[model samples]
Target chain A: MGHYWQEISALTMRWVRRLSREKFSMLFTLVQPMLFWLIFFGNLFQRAADTQVMQAPNYISFLAAGVVVMTVLNNGLAGGVDLLFDKENGFLERLMSTPIHRTSVILSRFIFVMAITSMQVLVILGVAYLFGVQPATGILGVAMILLIGMMFGVGLTAISMAMAFSVKSHGDFFSVLGFLSLPMIFLSSALVPLTAMPGWMSVLAQFNPMTWAIDAVRPLILSGWTEALPHVGMVVLVMIVFDALCLYGGAKAFRRAMG
Target chain B: MDRTIAIDVSHLSKTYDSYRAVDDLSFQVYAGEIFGLLGPNGAGKSTTLRTLITLLHPTSGTATVMGHDTVRDADKVRTLIGYVPQERAIDRFLTGREHLQLLGALYHLTKEEAAKRIAELLKLVELEAHADRPAKTYSGGMKRKLDIACGLLPDPKVLFLDEPTLGLDVQSRLRIWEYVRMLKARGMTIVMTTNYLDEADQLCDRLAIIDGGKIKTLGSPVELKIALGGDIVSLTLKETGRISSLESDLTGRPAIKTVRATPKGLDIRVESPEKALPAILESANRLGCNIEFIQYNRPRLDDVFIAHTGRAITESIPESETV
Candidate 1:
């Protein structure tokens, strides 16, 4: 329990794999995004080609990158709501009585949720690959992008968990998720690029963490890492800062939850 | 607080602005005893348990388990104790075997060790027949057994059970009681908290009767009953309204120290009901109160509780404390 990274990783792995075995939520996490990629983006892209002033590239690839970020954000955003069920069942109290490492308990959950989301991203990419699209970067870039994306995902996860600890039941967490998730996704570059949105929306996107992640990964996926350094550095910096801050907030919130 | 005891709690109080959930509570659970903390709902039993278990920080005091401070050495405490929380905690999606194995692995058991422990716990809770089925498919009793199995996965030295058989069927409750007895025989120290009075009466070695965040009394059941002073007389009244007026009239009578209206009839607490019966009958004949049924029985825990708290054991209900 003292140095819990390995144990946390193992636990996280188990939880993530367990998600695949679960039905309702797992379906939402894995398949729902795929449908969004196909239907919503497909409809919008059909009309984008007719705009004579600007070129809309292969809309599917454009949408796939968004799906990756969306998956991470969605996964991160949903992490703590599950704890509500744990509270209801009394498992949270049971775990607290154990001699397990506290850090492992917190970090392992984030690692696991993000890990499952990463698998979902892979599935999206796999299907995207079948449609004649390729990641502009190779395995290394994809892995690094994922790593960064995951770290940011952890930050968002911390925020959600912090919120969950303050709420009494799962019902409250579900409603709060809407208030947190939609704004972050919309304000970020999930559905469209910053330039494509209205002026005020672009300005709002500038401050959005999801927008930062989307900008960081889109170039890496669309044109590979060789195309930008400053952009990548900015996203990485934002992710790390938020990751540290949110974790601290989460730990504080978790400690308070016991009261 | 000395940091050497297996479980030490001191002046622990928690307040929610105005609610005052737990107030200056203190207790110690040593190495090996099936200690029961008995109380009614919202008597802060689970809050006290949670604070000792290191799930919550005390607003004022401190608790240490296994010679490690709950606040400073929570991870160590987590490694040392197995807790069966009050609410039934189980993932319906996971199989019994898988859930046990997953929990075992979390405790850093080698795959072999995890499997072995899982196997033992499954059989111990009598879930060996359905080890491979998902917990969702389980009956409430089966799920409850599996929940207990999950707690046993780590083989903890001190087991903390918070209402282990709550909401279980009679048969399942019997089986779980048997399992709990077996656990105690293995020399494990268990600290059990229950709002249900009977569970404590049946399962505990020694009980602490808690009310309104304070220990009202602590002793073996027999000792507590004996200390309550005398045998009880219960009587059913032909009519309840006839007794109250005559109760005060009988109190100063030869054999009567006090008179109480019981569900059975008008009961007279006395030194000798048999010797004083004719005098009581003469007095009652003057007052004209008829009795339906009557019996003399030994005092029970509920009576003891009433004597001390001046309230019925079953009343004054508060919400189930969500730990």
Candidate 2:
């Protein structure tokens, strides 16, 4: 068991080390979410909603949770690109030929995604704070934000990895990724509140796991723990089920692809 | 003087949906020998190697490497063997030393052990100078050498090189041959697959000629060549009509072992072409056959393959693709 974790951590550190070496790409990943927050949401929605009615002191605090979730979503979706390229270039075949535990491959990818996602979330949250958006729950709120982001990210990363193994090429993988990422974002409350959307779309948002993650995280950032725990519990439960299903499905798809 | 079997594959067959890639294949590789799975593309050479390395599951049958079943005890089998895939498997973002250290750790080597092994491997492959540079900066031959070094990091008892020199230049290929020889001298068992007849003949201690998912023949290079007898005799006749009678006349002669009809001539396997040629001519003359040209020469691995399979090895494989 100790050795298994050693392999998983070694492989995870490999990705993290690679990520750190690509300074331009690493900066781009964190900067892209901040750009969306500053330009796409901040400038556009500066005076669109009332702070009192929206249940927040300001729009930036409300939007901060969304940016955090979006970072998780983007990182999770992009997580499988490495796996797909590995498969294409035969690196996966080399890794599989070793005596290492098979699940460690998928586990390492998830850990890498969560680590990068956590870093991006910190950068986004720190920028949001500097712009005068403070989480009501303070330091604890950051922990909740990371936990929620990771739970939601793990499931999506699993699905993305499953797609990576099943698809034939990067073209096909990106096509499916493009088709899923935007709709999941728009359908959820990432860029807008569920109440602001049309009735049917709002109901759909209620079922979106991203919505559960954001709704849970929004209160932690804006209204404090008093009103956040119940929603947080529900999101945690939903994420557990989601992670379980995706992990099982991903492992099965991976085994079939190996065959 | 006792040799143990390193790999034992029996009644192995793997079918991809409707196509049977490996069909009822069986063979044994002895410990401490370089074994070659010699075949053209898609002849099931890669399929067999993949199964033994635990990359592909056999549809039916058993493959045991180092006494561990590949399917039932795949992890054990994996621990004993290293595999260099047909395609390059290095991470362009990682340095050659980094790749080695990571792979060594994945194989459960301690950090210090991994570092020492990485250093030794870098030196062994002669990549010590460029070990710190990213693999993307390396040339094709350099990348291939790094790949082999990565495979060897674990000090596995058996190493599988799947067409290790497939696309390499002559110099790089010879360099790889030297590495293989050095590994074998250290008592490591090696299994390699190749379509190049000379690679199999020159590098392997034993070779298996696989075609259409079966082992057509198996032996050392000299044994296989010897199997075709001492020499090959080719006689072209002026009259193609007398081929059958001339073929039968040469068959079962005192010195001629076997006679095969070629498009323009009769090819005979003989103990001594000098002794067999005149008697063959006299018999053919009695049968009203006129010889236009005649040539005698030593047999080659290609001739051995042809004799066993009824067509030249490369001819049976379509020209459009070699895989």
Candidate 3:
């Protein structure tokens, strides 16, 4: 067990060091979504949007939760590209040939991606504050939002990792990623409220785990604790089921690739 | 020689779908010796080495390293071996020191032990000056040295190097060869694969020449070369088409053991080149085959490869079949 922890920390630290060295990538990854989606898109839609129908004080406040969840989704889904590159470059093979526990490889990647996602979440929230968005439940509400984002991220990261192991090449992984992310974001209550969406799109959004996550977080950011807790419970249940399936699929792919 | 076997492979084969990458190959490496798998690309050299290191399971039969079965006791086998794969494996963002530190941690070395070992290895591979630089900043030779240093982190009983100098320049290749020799001097058993005949001939104590997923021959470099019996007198004729006619004339000569025709000449294998050269020239003269050049030398590893597989090691194998 001690050895396992040592190996995981060592591997995780490698990711941390690599990220720290990539100053340009780190800057863009943190700033891009906040710049385009939260500020520009929020202000653009602010005048056009029906705040009464959407049930929010303003569009920027409403878009804050969406941007937070979307950051998690985007960062989580793209997490496994590094692992896939390792496989292609033969670093994964070298790691497997060592005496360390094989599970350490997967677990370390999860830790690194999640840690980075949490930091990005905090940065996005800090920027949203400048736009006059605040969680109705205050600091505790912010913590709950982070918990929900992480829960949603767990499943997305698993699916990404499974795709990384199962696909023949990075090109194939990216194609599948593009196909999944756009539809998922558009189909969910991410950019728009479910009440405003078309009847058919709303029905599809009901099935999206992203919609459940966004609906849960929107209330905490725009409404108070009373309205947010029940949705939180529902999103938790959805996350449980979603993560179970993704983790099962991910484990199978990992075995096929590593075994 | 202690002669205790370091690795024993018996009827080991690995197949990918219908294509057999390794075909019932078997050989043994004795303790404290450098063993080479000599072959061309796609000859299953890497497959054989990967299996023995417990990276790939054998499709049939078995392999053991230091008395541990490769598949059944893979973890035990891993602790005892180090592998430097054919492809360069390095994190471009990590410094050379960081790479070794990470490997040390993975290998479960204590902080003090890892530090001591990493310092020793950095000096051994002569990378102490460049240890602080990220691998992306290092030259090809430096990256390779870091890779070799990573493999040596555990101070393994056996080291596996697959094409250690595949893409390096001549100076880098020579430097790597020196490091390999230095490792051998410390009494570690090493298994390496290479398509370069000179690498096998000059570096290996014993080698297996593989072709088409099979071991065509196995012996020490000197033994394999000497097994061809006597010397070779190669006569390059000015006229190419009259080789068969001259071949028949020299076939039954008492001094010559065998006559094999090459693209430019006839390679006459003889018990004594002194006695056979005159007879070979006489036959070509009588046959109106004008000799353009004459070369004579003792049998080399390439001749050994030709004698077994009937082709030089440089002949191409289809790219798709390479592992």
Candidate 2 residues lying further than 4 Å off, grouped into runs, are: A49-53, B1-3, B226-230, B233-268, B272-295, B304-323
lDDT for each residue of candidate 2 in A95-203, tens digit (9 for 90 to 100): 9999998888888998889988998888888888788888889898899889999999998898999999999789999999999888988999877788878999999
lDDT of 2 by residue, B57-80 (tens): 999999999999999899998889
Off by over 4 Å in 1: A1-6, A23-28, A38-40, A49-56, A137-141, A223-226, B1-8, B28-32, B64-68, B233-294, B317-323
Docking quality band of candidate 3, CAPRI definitions:
medium
Q: What is the Cα-based lDDT of residue A193 in candidate 3? A: 91
Span of 10 residues, lowest total lDDT, candidate 1 chain B? B314-323
- Residues A137-211 of candidate 3: C-alpha lDDT, one tens digit per residue: 999998998898888888889999999999998999999999898898899898899889999999998999999
**Per-candidate DockQ vs. reference:** 0.51, 0.78, 0.65
Q: For residue B280, give model 2's deviation from the true position in Å.
A: 12
Q: Name the lDDT value of residue B144 in candidate 2.
A: 97
Measured by lDDT, the strongest candidate is 3
**TM-score versus the correct structure, for each prediction:** 0.82, 0.88, 0.90
Question: What tens digits encode model 1's per-residue C-alpha lDDT throughout B80-101?
Answer: 8887877767777778887776
